[model samples]
Target: MPTTSPFALLLDVDGPIASPVTRDVAPEIIGLLLDLAVSGIPVVFNTGRSDDFIKQQVMAPMIAAGMPSTLKIHAICEKGATWFTFDSTGAGEVQVDHDLAVPGHYSDEIRELVASSFASHMFFDETKRAMVSVEQNIDADNTEYRRVQADFDAAALEAMIRLGLGVERLEVSLPDANSGIEYRVDPTIISTDIESVALGKDLGARRALNLLSADGIVPGAWFTVGDSRTDYAMADWLAAHGHEVSHVDVRPGDGIPAGKPYPVLTAGDLGLGDEVIHDHAGLAFLRHWRAQLDPGMVINSTELSEASV
Candidate 1:
């Protein structure tokens, strides 16, 4: 069945598109994606990767592997914390719309908590809002992940109470067992002052989406893809808002649900999973969904791009 709405193909990087280090992208899958592009289907890659990293590592190689130069491919990087558009006119340069920089005007108490806790573990990186994260190696088998996690949790709560800041949202994430902890802080409850440090690491992706939506990029026409639990905010937001397509879980055990609130596609294993997405089963699934939607639905990719500009 032919797709009607010119669907947005949201791809996750590590699982569905490319492998790490080798940076090998599947040729047949690229061909299929390019075919989708030629048919005017916009393919936007959404992942936890940063903007500079995606261009140097993922997009460049993909274009080298036959993806079109003018392929209207957009990227939501940093787990959807930042948004970028590849300028086909400028040697494929990526333009950033949102960044994970901490907002200015953070309460002094929040800063003190971060400074006090920063030395206990090498795991802490930066503080945003009431949350602080570090880069300590976590033993998935040690049962101590919870203990260390509790420490962070306690710190977050104390910081909020001491500073008279209210919690909006908080999360402690382990992006990699070897990479350390990733934390998020949402302090809209404290004030709309928008402190630079209040944005936190994990909130980047969700913040980017909110920024895009505010610019009139309706959720129904948008799609998001990611490899890990860190990407959950963007995925959850899109699903709750009824996005047209939200392809997630491009990595093995990315912890994506088997049946999602939205249509889900899993790549099975990293890099090699691209082959599965291009197979007959994958195509059939897309086709079946496409046949049900109305044609000529206007999607506002420019809204996201314009906001970034």
Candidate 2:
């Protein structure tokens, strides 16, 4: 850890900063993030959201919260395939940084197959640029999305194979295991991303850090917060680079490893308690940091136990 409070924050958009189920961002968290930025702490939202989602769900909210026109924010979207910056004006154009984007021909083929074969189970995201994604619509009468997800993934894989698109399997664990849910390729169960194997959160974090460094604004220590196992990739990358980075798992009981291969602290370890899960817990996590970073707040290392209930 840095001798002082960390200077930058790398956050995952969904689950940590936004509700995965409803896809909403709380106004309080938005205001807190903007205030942190104004306090000279750079915040980089590194996530799998597309540029369009980032603009509507994130940038627009900040603008409404009185973000200055001159203030700039950094974001790594589509996991690691796209990177961009937003000014007080609004979300800017994203630059696709990797050659791993699924070819248009391949994407078209996959889309056609999904639409023709499993239209009821999944709906494709039109805003996606580097990758293709299909979201699952879980019905209250039939909430088993995993079964549909398996069939959909198999079909999508077959389509990719037919198109000679290099493919790989990405496993995502459930946000809360106690919900009696099993881990699947889709962590949120709301969407499953089909992108090149080369793209991931680790790459996004590395790219964001490099970009921030280029601007001569390197952070003393880094902190990454997310609600899924996939989010651990960012912390894994930072630790491998010899940077002091802390990983905060906002999910209540995901059962991720706590040290070595992936040093992590559960949201409960941060005072969120074991029962507070999902977006509410995520909001609480952000609020804790906002208070911790207050100029008038003074806490000793040992006495900082209040940070973790």
- Who wins the TM-score comparison? 2
Regions of model 2 farther than 4 Å from truth: 1-5, 138-142, 170-188, 261-263, 295-309
Q: Model 1: per-residue lDDT, tens digit, 149-202?
A: 455555665554444444433453323233422234422110111222323223
Measured on C-alpha atoms, candidate 1 has an lDDT of 0.44
Report the lDDT tens digits of candidate 2 across residue range 1-309. 222336578999887787766677878778878988877788899989998888998899998899987678988998888988998787667798658677787678767877887677667789988888877653421256667777777766656555544454554322332332211223354778877667889999989888787766868878888888888899899989988888878773757865655457665565445766656666665666666778576444233333222
Model 1 residue runs over 4 Å out of place are 1-4, 20-23, 66-69, 87-99, 102-224, 246-260, 263-309
Clashes (N, CA, C under 3 Å) per candidate? 20, 1
- Which structure among the candidates has the greatest lDDT? 2
Query: Relative to the unseen true structure, what is the C-alpha lDDT of residue 151 in candidate 1, on a scale of 0 to 100?
Result: 59
